[model samples]
Target chain A: MTVTCPDLSVEIAGLHLQNPVMSASGTFGYGVEYEPYLDLSQLGAIVTKAVTLEPREGNPQPRVRETPAGMLNAIGLQNPGAEVFIDDKLPALQRFGVPVIVNISGRSVEEFARLAEMLSIDGVDALEVNISCPNVQEEGMTFGVDCDMTGRLTEAVCAATDLPVIVKLSPNVTDITVIARAAEQAGADALSLINTLLGMSIDVERRLPHLGNVTGGLSGPAVRPVAVRMIYEVARAVDLPLIGMGGVMNAGDALELILAGATGVAVGTANFVEPAAMHQVIDGIAAYCRRHDVARIADLVGAVAADQA
Target chain B: MPRATAILRHREEVVSGHYLLTLDCPEVAKAAQPGQFVHLRIGDGTDPLLRRPFSILLAQPETGEVQILVRTVGRGTGIIATHDEGVAYDLLGPLGNGWEAPAGGEDVVLVAGGIGVAPLIFFADGLRLMERQPYVRSIFGAANQEALVCWTEFAARCDEFTAVTEDGSAGETGLVTDVLAPELERDRPQHVYACGPDGMLAAVARICRDAGVPCYVSMEQWMGCGVGACLGCAVPASAGGYVRVCADGPVFDATEIDWERMKRR
Candidate 1:
């Protein structure tokens, strides 16, 4: 009976999840667009694309390019603004019964706080703060790369809302764990890492960048090892629970992160390859638990052994 | 909207570097419309990560078959170009909205450039079975006659077809717009449909705009999810901001797009 029924439930930052797999922000478009391909109610959670205070047109075409074992996208956070997101996109997702984790971006700490206050509605479960956008007040410095800014931004957002705040850390930084620790110390409820690695591709023949934005974020299998390393480091440095994501494709890849310290794993680029990938990851996690005699998936979080022998 | 593992019924070399793949997917074929596409997982590997989008060239629901034209221009297409028959493909389809055809009788002109002809062929085939067929004339262009994929089959399906090659290797030694200009003057076509490189589409859009004819263009973009979820395939819209080529359309009114401002990579 234990082998046949292994519990896949997980609790991260005070929210109960059916499983560990959630849609990575920017990759999953508000959860409703994928309705034709997969069942939404079965997902662990739905993380939306980045939402801003005002409507954004986003980067020009071409926005994506298929690279080795991965793909690069410079979507530039195109969204219908916060009001449209809550009024239009959120209502459709309310019926899915899955938690709606809204990923947000802002140019200033005030904007971040304002967004948090406005989005603290009945249906919203949490806030995944995307610290990737440039800080207009800081002379174009990225908030995630600056330790002091990250902490201040995290504190501002946490203070503005009652919902759990998950600060998504960027991998482009020299020390991601430092940023992760900064968020934890600043009252952040959770930390999600690593965001897509900054990478670029060139069209040698035409002497032009493949993406219109020139450099784009790299995601898929190519970034899994880096994601695991970052999660491992952040897990050790910070007391907050971690939502690990970056190139997560299947259960095994997800488990690798869970073992590294991620309580919840978000599937990003893989959703583009297979729309129903999160379901497979969830199913595979169950099979993995049953096979290993692990009764519940939460037991596997940060389960990696220090010594292999 | 089914995620199907479609099997390859057959593969044919339409021309050098261009191949036709017939897939056995009942759900996709049964629901397939002209100008819509299928996203194909290239291989059982991640090196070429994103699924490649190929516009449907033909759909035979009775046979549960759909076909795509693959030009070996990149690693993804190269993989499919050499794939053997009977191999199963991880597929997602009848994805995105199909072309909105003319309601009934209208003077419609289809302008295709090279493999951009694929979806137009599907459109032509679809028009034949419609209750009222439009007066269709097509103009196909290629770098050269040898590079041209299909104009004969397109000619058979339409009321009239014109072929153009840059070097005069086949028909008119000029662009599709060269023929379209005189054709537009000959009878002021009611509607124009086009697909090809961005430059060609832009030129065609200009002609249609000048002639005050409604034009529909099937755009090609670097796509992530063929579904609208990713919002990766963005094209500039005239109404301000961007529209997704994958969702808002692989097909859109020429006027809906702000072509002058678009920087298509």
Candidate 2:
């Protein structure tokens, strides 16, 4: 039987996702938090938080603060480390019946390799090397801003893990596509761009940085345009599949990512605003297909040619 | 687990500064408790990503109406206030553990600071409806007289109500804690309930600690997922580490909270 609503299913880095709407790392916990709020089975995949070589308690107080149309967070990647994730979090994620993409961050190149090696053990669908995190004291923005380092690190993780590797790019770079191209050259199976743009909010009265860490990554509707522009640019520069996300709040926004050449979209800051927003976006995509007389969801991917009106 | 549709039924601009939004989500209203809250969707698109959180001011199940008192302080709240009535507003709710009202015939002390009074309003009403002859006292504070929103309703219901303004425009001059200082010393309330800005709650928690009385204070946090998952809305607890404000509480026992760390935040 032919699928009625154009096939929205997308395959990224060997993971056969039924759709392209994955939950962004750090937004959706290992896959349990939304169980009480929404059905996790509907999502393309659930990306766990940035897993480290060892457990981290994260940053100090005032980890988060609200900004204009966005928010600044310096969580410092407080995760249960890679072992705990593989041992504890992965089993729980398996029950969701969706692919699980493990997001790994590191303080050094070796740490990234170690995390990748550990995550390669079963249960994970892909490895999203998070070179986008801006909280740590070292190696946060370093690898992302320099295309050469990004390429070097992506290759390290690719060599460490047997699973498909998707390098998450940072938006803080001067040219995001430069790093995207580098990751592709380094053997990354796919790319997830762009991570939160570097930002900070000041408490005028206190005359101090609003977030615990002086600066934080900015996310939400405020950064969508920047993310989309970067994703479109990166899409043309690299041939690998793209996972586009930044302040995506609806199905139309998800569609925009696909048209801009993203093979999938991750729902991030949108979860903070509304828990069930991703499911709604999924339904909206189906309705959009019917309205546009489209047969398959995959047909819309990269369909907006440069000559289009 | 209810795949319930939360439609924006009515959006009333209550007072110039706050919007009294009503969501027609029957499951949420039916399942809602006294101190629970809902996460609201912002903007028609994802540009202003993240859901804004608001405590449940009132949930009328008979009418399928759940109300949220939103103060337009930022982009999310501003977007929520401007949402047109009849449009669909996405919401995930009736989440978080609520305040535990006195069982019966117990003197109650209610304290609110600025917009903090929003969530506790329903709790006070619930106490009065129980007909427990509660020696109710409400100590509220605001920057000035104009910032106070529900003083009239609080006064009519509370057995003894005291309003404190920073500039001495309304009631007591110093702070809500100053007004409550004497009450704890003289009246010695059996149980206390409080909600307000963090600074005020910190002071209230200290007072409760000094008096050796039990207190429940509702907390506010900028959350990602209002459910227990994201751990974005965690507040440090005296027990250790952090507690999810959306799941473990918006209402936490005063003594159980880590006031020292929260003050720093």
Candidate 3:
């Protein structure tokens, strides 16, 4: 007897995917670093690290510190700038045969637009505008904190490139729905939430901050609940497709976000725990679909009962 | 590059708060090199979610075994220290740039302080496996006698081994640099390799610079992805910009590091 494979294909905006599992930006580096561990083509999409108009050296040492169930990091959006990334890194990513979503962070709306235009090349499939990097002092704040700024930034980025624009939202705000709605109204093709929550840790013995930056954005299992809540809220509030991520370690966690209304799911901190975690998640989702007798994996998106909601 | 499940073969408290864990992983051992490290998943679930990075202390491919020296510093290491023989650990390695083996017949000095001895021990072992043996001097220092680790194993292999403590408990009474200074002035070993705390490494780098001896030092930083993807382990380079320790060189030329900025971290 032959077993039928469930359909796992998903489309966000106009971008097609073999599956609905993509590696979150910053977690999976340029899609080439994990090549030795897993098949790159297996992923739905590969989101490159936060690229900038100018080369950024990032924060100083002790940039990461493990917390109870998660970790805090203030990498400050380190990248080789768009020109070098296109020349040096993009070729390696193109070899994978997977959709490449470039995540870009800018110090201003013009910078974001400039990056979007520069990265709108033949190989890039989408642009993920990172307006929520808490590690950077000046830039992320101006664009992400206020609703008008978020909308304006999203609008400028969308206008710069013909590629699908995905705005990544930060959870360190009063109401993430406001920013989500703003991005949606500004013609964002899709939305990814939530970027790491702002947090900090201290070394009591030395009376010093744990991270060199003193504070960092927290990621991992500890922030899963917050991610799900925001995704659920933003999905209901906005009409755009959603890409959800936060502490996604396995297939079960990926499904949790999909049920909450994410068209696709991303694996972040789990990449560090198991380099093959995205593959496992992709496989696990297929296995779940087969067990549940669901013909299409897309049926699982936002499948939670309205009464339960 | 192979991710494999390693079976625990042996575990013992090599030093007071440090553990020596041996895993029977043929794939990792076969691919392992000196100064490269393994990222180990500590807990079964996501509570202690991230994998901890540990330097490969010994990799014996023939025996299909690799050893790591773990210090019980926090929750991750604390949980890892409790595992017994027969437990399986999901390991991703051998990651990062390991030591570049020195040319044969060159005078070499290996300096280590506290747990910094982890990677240097593997480097020394690799030298032994080579066709020619160089003039080797190993210097180890700790807070006290009990804090010193792997002295016996290192002593058995090197031509001259010196263990020092701040309290004058065992071999000598001063810092490891005290011994490293005169050795640099007199013989001036062709190459100096070191691993330890930032202060110790900085001192070693300074001494090597003054003596005009090329030095390579292994650095440690809180890392996210042991692979270079997550730029979490950024170290300021002496020349200009920052370099990711995981990708660039956990082992770097002593002169490349910005010792002053590194101390701030």
| DockQ-better candidate, 1 vs 3 | 1
Question: Model 2: runs farther than 4 Å from truth?
Answer: A1-5, A60-71, A203-209, A283-303, A307-309, B1-26, B42-50, B63-67, B72-89, B131-135, B263-265
Which segments of model 1 are wrong by more than 4 Å? A133-141
Backbone Cα, N, C clashes tallied per candidate: 2, 18, 0
- Full candidate order by lDDT, most accurate first: 3, 1, 2
Q: Which is the leading candidate under DockQ?
A: 1
What DockQ does predicted model 2 obtain? 0.37
Error of 1 at A47 (Å): 1.0
TM-score of each: 0.97, 0.87, 0.97
Put down candidate 3 lDDT per residue, B1-265, tens digits, no spaces: 5578899999999877899999999999999989998888875787787778889989999999999999898888887788899999988888889889987988999999988888888888888878888878999999999888877877777889999999999999999999999988878899999999889999999999989999999998888888888988889998877888888979999888999888453
Worst 10 residues of 2 chain A by lDDT: A1-10
TM-score of chain A of each: 0.96, 0.96, 0.98
Over the true interface, candidate 3 deviates by an RMSD, in Å, of: 1.2
Clashing pairs in 1: A69-B46, A69-B47
Worst 10 residues of 1 chain A by lDDT: A132-141
Residue-level lDDT tens digits of model 2 in B132-169: 66778888899989778767866777888888999999
